[model samples]
Target: MIDFLNSIDTQLFLFLNGLHNAFFDPIMYWLSDKWIWVPMYVFMAYLIVKHYKMKGILIILTVGVVIALCDQTASHLIKHAVMRLRPSHEPSLVGLIHLSKAGPGGMYGFVSSHAANAFGLATFLYFVLDGRLRILKYWLFIWAILVSYSRIYNGVHYPGDVIVAAIIGTLIGWGMSKLFLYIENRRLKNK
Candidate 1:
């Protein structure tokens, strides 16, 4: 079953990586670049501050926790445990894979930190905002999807890697959001 799933993952990776073109190569590279999203990060900070005011600090802290958890889990724990080679680094996929200038990232690519972090933030915000700013919350998901897809497009991650990372991220996000809410409610009650 594992071999069968790996075969499908390879095929899917090839299909998605093959879709790259001159027009989208740079765009995908940009999307996959972590530093390129600083403006969006700043905007998120502004929104949290604007909406939650003093409590925005707490929200921001929770966001940090979510990202830290996602990054460590995806990059350190799972990747090391699985030790699966990225498509770019896979000998069988040497000629078949398409990589941006960024090249193959770290050796293992079982779960993508980029996808985890993006989806983690998106899921957390979606729940935190709840009914208040419906459009913004929905847009957060679109952003997460695009970021996750970009990992596959850039050839560093298989679709399965991104999918699993997204699931893990969503779960972590949900858990953190629940914890944040519980703490917030308790603080209010005490006040």
Candidate 2:
């Protein structure tokens, strides 16, 4: 069953990764790059400060911690333990996969740190600012999904890796957000 699933995974990966084109290649590569998203991060910081005001500092702090936790859990604990080779690095996929100048990333790719960090930030932001900004919440999730898909497009991660990482990241984000809110609320009442 596992082999069957893995075979299907590889096939799906081929289809998705195969859909690339010259014009979109650079876009996907840029989307997968962390440094390219600095403006977006700055915008998110602006929104946090604008919306939460005094609490924004604490929220931003928690967000950094949440992202760190997600990255560590996915990269160190999960990916290392699973030790799955990235499609670009797989021997069978040597010629079968398309790799960009961005490269295959780390040797293991079971759980994508990119996907985890994206989803963690999206989910955390959603929890903290959902009702406050109705439509933007949807956009946040869309951004997270795109970030996950970019990993597959980059050939550094399989779809399953992104999916599992998103799920794990969601849980981590939700838990951390809830804990922070709980503490914040308690502090407010005590004051």
User: For residue 1, what is the lDDT in candidate 1?
Assistant: 100
Candidate 2 global TM-score: 0.96
Segments of candidate 1 deviating more than 4 angstroms: none
- TM-score for every candidate vs. truth? 0.97, 0.96
TM-score: which candidate is best? Answer: 1
> After superposing candidate 2, which stretches have Cα over 4 Å from the reference?
none
lDDT of 2: 0.88
Report lDDT per candidate.
0.90, 0.88
Query: How many clashing pairs in candidate 1?
Result: 0
Stretch of 10 with least lDDT, candidate 1: 128-137
RMSD values for the candidates in order, in angstroms, are 1.0, 1.1
Q: Kindly give the number of clashing pairs for every candidate.
A: 0, 0
